[model samples]
Target: MPMDERTRAEVERAEAALVEHYPRLVRLAYLVLPPSMGRHRKVLTAHGLVQRALPWRAPRRPAGALPAQRGADPGAGYDLVRQRTVELALAYEERQRPAVLLPTVPFVWGLRLFPRAGGADELALDQALSAVPAAVRAALGLWQLEGLDADAARAVLVRAGVADPEAAQRAAGQVDRRTAGTAALLNSGEFDPCTVQARPTDLLRRRQRVRATAVLAAVLVAGTVAVAALPGGPPATGPVPTAAQQALDPARLLRTPHEQWAETSRVDFTAWPPRGRQAGDRQLLARALRVWAAPPPGTRIVAAADTSTRPPAAPPRLLYAGLIDNVMVVVLHDGERLVRYAEPEGATPTLHFARVDAADLTSAGGLVIGRGNGWLRYLIAPWVSDVAVRDLLAPEAPPHGLHLAPDGVTDRIPLPPADGVPCGHWPATQFRSSPRIDDRRSFLVTDLGDLAPVHLTYLPSPGAGGPGEATGTPALHSWARTACTLRSLRGTGVRAVNNWAYAQQDLPEGGGTATWVCNRADTWRGPGRAVVQFLPPATGPADPGKTAGRARGTAACSPFGRHVLGDVHWQAKSGKWYLLAAGSSEVAGIDVTGGVRAGAAAATLAVPAGPQAPVRVAGRLGDGRSLLALRP
Candidate 1:
């Protein structure tokens, strides 16, 4: 059928308007929905909803009729469309249940139409908004983003099914409180409205066709399945294991080695370049044996070394070295059993042992010399104790190597010093080292008795750019002292503790002040411990405007592990002025100096106030490993 000129013009005008406002509508929809639904899904749903609400399909009036001939308010048409779209989206979501529901509006537009900005702050706002319920989010969007007043926002929320006006007002207040900073950022030109690009008409039509086909196909398949399942049959089986899962299965790998394992474990024999083909062959065989052993769950063999690479003067000993996950795993086959040792990358290694069986021995081919060797060598290595294995491996060093005594022997094996520092009173149980960063700093954490970790940070010294300097001895000693103090504090029944270096100031004669911060026991039912520091102003005329008795320092605490602290303010709750800090987990508070301290009792510290009016404060965690905090 041929369309009349008026009707055709109206259709074109509606499409042009939709195209112009498509991106804005999509952004609004995205903000309306929870972020858990993901950006892509939200954009698509929003586009669809908007398209469906277009007035092109409405019954046409007689020729020469006015815009209001059908009783439509031309000025308020957009609002009506938006409201209808939101309602449709909500209804679709309700009916879809487990499935992804289509939003009320519709338009064939690409997601690139909506570009995101605002960086980390924007991301934080999005995450915060996601935590809010959909209704609350809608109210916020309407009130803040849409610049609607309280009554207007309430009306929108009421239309969206929020029955209580008080609830709507409360939601608006919460949004205002939570997004105050974000709103400032948004208004500060951090985010510009995304420009809409014109998409090809053919591409848009093709997308619509594809979407329609997908919907029709889905409906047909659903109908067919419903008819076929009219009579119940046997229960469905669980999903089949994927190829990756099958390859990773320890049982399957033990029974029959997967072909993928060969590639994963292959090592270049040429890298060693043995003196003779015999040595090279031996090295190849050792590499093959190490590969055959395979890594435990969540680890992989990155590098391997063995006796084949040993010097001719060295005694005959079968050894294999591999990187398990990021940790180093070294295996040695003794006459009795196979000794397995593992160390986190750059950390002290730990030792274990496993029994060898005849079948296991044969699995390694000619590599087996001891009765308990062979494939059984790889299978039986059990982790012994949570201690460093480096000392056990290096017998010729200062500390004698750990000797494997007979069963029931009561000899204590000597272990090497961790990071050149004697363990002393603090024995290392487990150790972890993070990857070296910028070739300058690396962190090593040693799990001491009772899981108290002594964190060591290795950094380049003055005049050195790489990680070759060894000038951190003083820092290490300082950390050890702090760790000891924290250990004692823990002994006093303190829970949920962490320690960190808060402030450092260079002093005269190359000396410096290093302040440490730690969370005390949570006996007060508050969020966490509160530590406030005060430092006297620097002497001299460096800043002539500097006032006297002005104390400057940091205050910080954490209820759990390392968490980014949010806003801090003097909040008055129940007639008490509390120094409160908010984070993602919970808000922590400590009684301010001169605040009401009666009702409840817990250990309290007086924040130093030395005649400084309008006292300024800041909070800090710690730099690298200077401050240590324990995780439960």
Candidate 2:
């Protein structure tokens, strides 16, 4: 049973590539697999699937190829391997749990009860997918994760035994509905596997152990030969630990609070930016108070306080300790600030603090602490101890600061300039007019000694120019009026604009309205330059005569249409002008100006145009709703 030289080489190559792409494969598996499987199992399953599907043979290269092209291309090969692996895993799932007819009432109710408490959109999506039928889930995974089109996705489903085209289309539609607001989140690279920590090596070891265990069990059951008995049989099962025993265990201390007062134990404060050697416990207490008070106004503070005098060997330094609302708040504060941390149960504790507030305190009674000028009194649980506090903080450096880019009409914290200037202060403003061309908008300069400007945009009053309006221009003009009107549509329940193009408006009547507007004024010129049209809901019959034309590039008129026409732009890559478009569901780019009716999906337009020529492209959907974009 020895392996041949070729097979050994192939296995080595496959292992190397898999090791490099392990994280990505795990993330892909997390998305495609059902949430009920949990993180560890999902990672293990993904590793197994990827291992089985890898093309272990050395890649074939054309003769006379350069040295650079001689070896196997892991990146190119990975995509195919990953796709095949997901398809196979899904197929296996389908076979394991074949489609079954369930009672309609209970099935609908079960969908409602599915868990939906995941903090991130990606996690929420995984939970949502659990409620979806297996066939529908497969369809969605193929489209969302694999970037397959409806037709391609349908073909895959059909091959998997979902023979009916309508059923496949219905599954695709269900995916579109369930993942409406989360499509971008699912496609983003910021996935966080909360509890799963298995690596490729771990998976390999687990597989080997499982095989060994199976062989041992089979041998024992068969009793083919009289085997020498070991010293002892399987270990005896012990009774469950009592409440007292559980309370004493350090691991269970955080979850279960003890009523009996135990001697307070002190441990070394290990958080970085170590507290000054001379700093006393009182000073540490004050520092913790400051952090609690510094959070932006309206932030609720939850904290615990401990005044026990019992000191154990190497007691935790009072780096930062305070009581905000009575729950004892203690952290291994660096000399300057509380160490940033996070701790998920069962994983190694980290130094990052969770965003805790008054609502989080479980204690009923309040506590009193003397502050500089007055006594600080707040309600917090007394059960939280120093040991629990240590468990709460994650032991890691702070994540990168989040910088929210400014939307047209909101005050935003400006990011620091490249010169390492600090953001100073931005005075609150009541109302500010949109920026007009040639007119300077007032800026709030930070006081951090840096001249960083935080721009504030407020809702325009009755007569104020629209958001981003050009200055020194007459307000009652053609395109300007249209812009103003579009802005005014916000009053009609158009809460926000998606990609600055599509507006979802709720009608005064029952059904909602989806409008596509051309926000770009400089390039829009033809007869129907600023296209604003209503899109049909996805529940009704398709509208006739809604085809790709000069006025409408790609529009959907079907009930399932939820298309948005992204801004059209030309990119020169490899000496060809590539038109790019993006939207919900599916987007197709059509070369209307070139008189070509054929359409290509949203990522990149199929037609190649000259750089000098103006490209007029339309984004269309399967149901026939279209929006024309002219980039001159």
Candidate 3:
């Protein structure tokens, strides 16, 4: 049935706010549920319920605050939505497959966990809600449902003769009595989802074991229902406990015999090859275990995927790669691990092997896609940077310049052609041809390629926008003669264009502009500050004009990787440069830094954490020290 104008308008308002907050809310719901619970199932089901119960329409333009819910608790709106949703769901449950039951209203709450709604606390929320009783549930559903104004609802109640405040209060006490009637079902105002449900389950053992198991079969049921009530807060995954406040000082680990060989491939210390799951309780693929820890140098080496070198075979599985930058992982999966590897032994490397890839090669690591695809096809030579190097060579120019762009980093600014600059022109060279050093880190070895003083000019930030939006390109142009190399550093932003590292930023009220980077020496400045090489540009829409971007007071700079990044969001608040680095593990940090010696300090932010997040993810739970989740 078409919703009435009033309901439609209310839904539209709620929906707008909902859509804005959905991503975080859904993620939070899932976190509370745990992957094993199939949070996906609950999410799909809940969203479906919302669609049917509260269809929305275009809202009439309203100047300000929504119709107030006088005398109604803040949760009243959602409770109404929940009640309506449940009615629809229960009717359909007869025909639907058995699935996890979820709360219809998702007003994510976790006071302490603002800006985030995931990780461990979600689990607690889940446990707490599962303990809600029938009466409490009814009260919760009726009161928190969406779109009902308190006065209107109260008027309806008055008409229904449910009684005035005094009478209603008397009736509420009976449900309250039942709510905490059982020891297992304590009506503690404070919630503890996990334990709450567990107590009920325990009670069922003496009464109805079979019934208990049948009722809460799906994990999502416990997860969603329990967590749906609380405000989503600090990411539970939080950061890894600070690593003893000390650097690995790699020098300590017994130096492997093949240091040169290891460096050749960029030995990644955290090379997790895609998670290998062996739920059968059997040994995980032996080859996987073997590769988990680097081989003891002297052990007999086998093939890349060969499983024979190692013994027991287990089910093969995909592994998550945990690799450090500038480290090549020399994986010899002891014959057994190879069970999962596909082998076409006779195959040969095509003259032009496939291209464009990423594998945790840097600190600000994520997927860095080089924007220009057509540029490569159009170039006369099938190469990245058109530079030439002989025997041992160093990375000079963009592609070879360990940058985040399609090419590593682009040394766009030529430090001005010097009197004795080699070739005196930045020549075109391919990354493959460069001589590498410390884990793909190599110097611009003299023999690598011919010196070409390539003067590639570019307009600065706010490239093509009109008026005040006209943030120009890097005005400070440099002439490159000798080996122009780039060493990838860290920075912030989302996709290549959305990234701040390679873009420009304008000051508020159209003050001045600052480009994303400033490269000095071979090393690139990082986390979106300092001088760094530019990645080669591929054709795309010209950057938004500084004026266009700055209108909202944010300058388009670097695009974020997985986390969202934008000038409007990050820039407006702090005129200073910020780096949205994969600060640590899954943890994304907002920080600022200067030149090489510059130390980075975390910026106050509100991001959630996960099981695999980094250290310093959240400022120490209560103390200055971070809190790590340990299974009790």
Give the winner by lDDT. Answer: 1
TM-scores vs. true structure, each candidate:
0.35, 0.27, 0.21
Per residue, candidate 1 scores C-alpha lDDT tens digits across 417-519 of 3221333433211221112212223222322111112222322122222222111343333333333333322211121233233323232223233222332
State the TM-score for model 3. Answer: 0.21
Give the Cα error of residue 575 in candidate 1, in Å: 29
Estimate, for each residue in 193-223, the C-alpha lDDT of model 2 and write its tens digit.
Answer: 3233322322333454576699789878867
Q: Which ten-residue region of model 2 has the weakest summed lDDT?
A: 386-395
**Each prediction's whole-model lDDT (CA):** 0.34, 0.34, 0.26
Q: Cα RMSD to native, each candidate?
A: 22.0, 24.7, 27.7
Instruction: Give model 2's TM-score versus the native structure.
Output: 0.27
Ordered from best to worst TM-score, the candidate numbers read 1, 2, 3
Instruction: Write model 3 residue lDDT over 323-358, tens digit each, in one string.
Output: 112211111222113212111123211000011112
| Ten-residue stretch with the least lDDT total in model 1 | 373-382
**Model 2 ranges with Cα > 4 A deviation:** 1-26, 55-83, 91-120, 160-169, 189-632
Q: Quote model 1's TM-score.
A: 0.35
Query: Which regions of candidate 3 fall more than 4 Å away from where they truly are?
Result: 1-40, 47-145, 149-357, 363-632
